[model samples]
Target: MKPAPFNYFAPESLKEAITLLERNHGTSKIIAGGQSLLPLMNMRLATPETLIDLRNIDGMKQIREVNGFLEIGAMVTHQRIMTSTLVQEKCPLLAEAAGHIAHRQVRNRGTIGGSVAHADPAAEFPTVVTALDADIKIEGPGGEHWLKPAEFFLGFMMTTLQPTDILTALRVPVSPPRCGWSVQELARKENFFAIAGAVCLLQLSQNRVVDVHLGIMGCSPAPLKPLQAEETIRGQELTDDLLAKVADLISEQVEPESDLHGTKAYRRAMAGVVTKRALKEAHHRASEGRQ
Candidate 1:
């Protein structure tokens, strides 16, 4: 099905886009790469009266390193993320995860911003950012502000963004030395959405955990960090038994809904499976000094 009739706009400037959004009074949607939104519009799941395109805005398509953090423009495509040498060297977790997104064409068109804004629980970027402790930048009538991943994402596809606010970019700290990260998912097929997924970041020194971050997706309304589980193993010796313990803690903490894709019990169980896999892989990578 085709989308409902709506005004289409390609704004050349961020200010212009914000103005158009404000003028529309909550009936407009800001579009970046059109990878996620177009599908929703096509299915009539979203019916915004005005579509304010951000693709024409040049400022939002950059990757810069500043003050120990990588400021990745929201418009950065998944394909680009997978290929960028800087991202590969400084934030290899993002590159690895980007490679798992839907096929080539979709990755070329799908954007970090659009995915984050869409807030799909199964999406890779959201869980990656959560584990990385990333921040989101936004601009609106009230001016600019930044929000941590936890503050930016609400349940499901919801966000704290006002209708007139434009999410401009994401900032992530550079991965530390001896850092090991892994993305594990239980997808029906390659490049498809996961029934349950887990991301793990581990920093190791002398075969012990220096720091660790764990984030899980596809098991809750929003991607979540099982903080208690992470803390349980943080600064502790890395062991198979410890990993299993952490995975069990995460499984007990996960809350998945029953859907056509998987049963709640099944997805919840898979969450622990992925977490254990992710933890093992990450630990191996850390041992090998790979990131």
Candidate 2:
């Protein structure tokens, strides 16, 4: 299948891009890497009267530090993040998770903002950003606005972005001292979508849990942060039994859907298992920080 006839525009500047979007309004769609939208368009699942390509916009492709946070351009590809020296040094968790994306072929062309905008429940970048407590920057006729990951990702393949809005960048807080991060996912095969994935960030103080972020994927409509699990482990020394309890708690709370990849029961159980594994690994890394 091929996409329906549509006018295409490669705008050189963001101001021009948003102007085109506003003029096209309900009949337009934004294209970043075209990794996701192109396929959908080919399938006729998404047919827009106009397609606005953002790749030509100059400032949306760089990664730099600003005001104590790493500001990643929306057009930054997965492979770029995977290899970026700054990303590796400041947010290695994101760097590691980027390697788990579909494949080198896709990573070479898939933009971080595009993936987050695509918002597949099992996607690595969205879950990583959520765990990192990142902020999304968007621009439109109304000028600029920032959204939390929770606020930005409203549902699977859905976001709060208006038709005229462009996702410009992501701002991730630099990982703190003594912070350990890990990604544990259950996938049918390497680079396949995760059946269930857990991204954990653990910060320890004197052998007690100072803070923990548990970002879950493939078990709910949107990426999740299991507050119960975080609350249960905070300010306490991690024990095997306690980890088990936290895992069980997450299993009971996640809402997995029945699907062809696996049964809801299977995904639900795997979600818990990955959560425990991720937390355990994070703890190990944090301990190594002491050495």
List, residue by residue over 99-161, the lDDT tens digit for candidate 1: 989999999999999989889988999989888889999999899999998898888888898
RMSD of each: 0.9, 1.4
For model 2, residues 1-291, the per-residue Cα lDDT tens digits are 988899999999999999999899889998998888999999999999999999789999999988879999999999999999898888878888999898899899999999988888789989988877799999998899999998888888888889889999999888887788898989889989999999988999999999998899999888988888899999999998998899899899888998999899999899999999999999999989921
Model 2, position 126: C-alpha lDDT score? 90
Q: In model 2, where do residues sit more than 4 Å from their true spots?
A: none
Colliding pairs, model 2: none
Q: What is the lDDT of residue 20 in candidate 1?
A: 97
Task: List candidate 1 stretches off by more than 4 Å.
Answer: none
Question: What local lDDT does model 1 show for residue 168?
Answer: 94
